[model samples]
Target: MTLTAAQTVAALATIAGSDNVVGDPAKMGAWLYEPRKRFHQSAAAVVTPPTVEAVQAVLRWANENGTGIIAQGGNTGLVGAQVPLSGNEVILSLARLDRIRSIDTAAGVMTAEAGVILENAHKAAEAEGSMFPLWLASQGSARIGGVLSSNAGGVNVLAYGNARELTMGVEAVLADGRLYRGLNALKKDNTGYDLKDLLVGAEGTLGIITAASLKIYPLPEDYETALVNIASPEAALELFQLMRQRAGARLNAFELIPWIGLDIQMRHGMLDRDPTASASPWYALIELSRMAGTAPGALQSSLEAAFDAALISDATIAESLADRTRMWAFREQMSECQSREGASIKHDVSVPIAAVPALIGQGVTAAETLVPGIRPVPFGHMGDGNIHFNFSMPVGADPKAFMAEFDEAVHAVIYDVVLKLGGSVSAEHGIGQLKVDLLRQVKDPVALDMMRAIKTALDPKGILNPGKMLRSVP
Candidate 1:
């Protein structure tokens, strides 16, 4: 028989501890709501297991009882992956497991508990004279477990990598409560199946990550930062190629921003001053890592070369720490400044690095065709081909009416262009409850079959994150 909400809470509290279980619905908002506020499902209860063994116990009990468990960290996920699908599920929060198990600077790895906050991990690595390079806006609250679960990518992905590439291995509790202790600092262990990759992006359907061995790198001595004005995305692409050729691995970041981003931020007083050289159609916030004893002004000289090649029009190279921070502030505040204007339809999609120009041109044209006067705010990691293609509703249009009418149709139009260009529908952001139906519509049938088979093989009971990523087989 199925247990009621009270019974489920009581059982979980007994297994873990009454003090760790939150049965009251009023207090479960933090775990239930996601960053976007798109999903608002109520969880049956929230359980914060203090130890790995406790997590295992909770999972075993959940599996046997056929209860759905949504493993969560920090609760700062953009997609609804870390939140509840059905109201009957229990949120298995990993917040209490925050700990750095070990840090081997010589090996360039840190074994951190799943609940270790991303910023804290950075501090720990910095304390050891190394750096964990995964830098996200939500790093202050986002945790290791959720970051790896989503395989998050950030601005630094150009120099470092996304969470999966940086992760060495993971220690997790399978749906059946058996611990999969695969954590290691080894660079090469061609063992069976490469299970760590499977779990890292699984969104906790296959397992609940308890700890992970993450690759850390030597700290760069300084960063040469600049904001260059570009004529268009085409020019931006050429400039990006020039940077890669010039800086090679030292090329840290290449972000593309439309002139509207600057206009919006300045209009809303988000920036102290314009960070670019002058008003241009587009901008590129570029940076290069300067190691110890390396010559400075590499980025400045690069801009000079770009000018000679006619890839850029004007530029403002950061002269001090404050200038670099302000330039980055302009790029980072692009998303929030849009909210100040009005509701915007956003897609975290990616295309080939070369086809970025075509993608933006074609996408903007299509969006305008559908909703005339819609403002296109296309920007993101130009180096990595991930553009956060977004559209601000027509000026003075009702935000709710605009989203209600165009959200679905706009997504269809954009996804069509993305697929035609051999691009991905979802890039940095993983498909959570938001894109379940979309994934089914766009994903290959054979890939879906394999995913379902793996889900069944690992979670035969279908008790882990039900109705997420892939729908119920039956």
Candidate 2:
């Protein structure tokens, strides 16, 4: 028989304590409330494990009882993976397990516990004379485990790669409560299977990540940032090629921003002053890392080339740290500013680098067709081809009613364009319960079969983040 919410709470309290297990719905706000506010399911209990051993004990009990369990970290995920879906699942929060276990500057590795905040990880690396490159706006709350599990990519992914690439190894507890000790700092390991790769982006469905050994890099001396005025995505893409050819690895970030983003931010007073170089149809927020012994003006020289090529009309290079901060604030605040404007439908999708223009061009046209006067806000990593393709509701439209009317219809149209251009619906964010159906529909049948088989082999009981990523049992 299935355990009641009361019984589950009692069981979890026994494993940890009454203090650690929160069954009261009112008190479970921190663990339940996600960033998007789309998922509001109540969990059976929120169990905060004080130690790795405590986490293991709770999992063992849940596994034996056939109870569902969801591993939660900082709970800052855009997707609903960190929160409970079925409401029957007990949330195994790793918040108390946060710690910077070790940092090897010479070896360029940092082993952080699952619940360590991403910002804290950065501090630890900086203290050791290195840097962890996985940066996001939610770094204040997003944890190491969740970041690795989701395989998050931020602006710097153009240079350092995403979470999966930066992660050297992981320590996770399988569904059956066996700890897989895979935290080794080996650069090259051609062992049996790529288990680390599978668990990194598995969205906590296959295993519960307890700790990770992340790749660290030498801190750049300074960064040369610019907000360049471009006519369109096509121009932005051309400018990106010029920068890649000129700056190479020093080209840390090359993001595309639309005029709509500037209009929204300025109208709402989200920024103290305009950060761009006057006004144009679009903008590209570009940054180049200046390593020790490297000269500056790499960004300036590249912009000159872009200007000569007629790809960019005007540009503003950040002369001071404050200038750089303001430029980045404009980029980072893109998602939050949309909320202030009212309801917005967002797609975190990606295509090949060359196909970004086509994706944006066709995607905007398609969304406008669905909802006349719909505002398209296509912006993000242009170099990596991941655009946070979002659409704000028509001005003064009822937010709830607009979403109710066109959410699914808009998705169908946008996703159709993404697939036709050889793009993915989910780029940075993983398929939490949000995209499971879409994944099943768009993914190759054989690839889906392989994913299901692997999930079954690793988590036979379907307890680790049940019903996430994979839709059904193999």
| lDDT agreement with native, every candidate | 0.93, 0.91
TM-score of each: 0.99, 0.98
lDDT tens digits, residue span 107-161, model 2: 9999999999999999999988799998999999999989999999998899999
Regions more than 4 Å wrong, model 2:
none
Candidate 1: give its CA RMSD in angstroms: 0.9
Give stretches of model 1 more than 4 Å off: none
Cα distance off (Å), candidate 1, residue 304: 0.7
The residue pairs found clashing in candidate 2 are: none
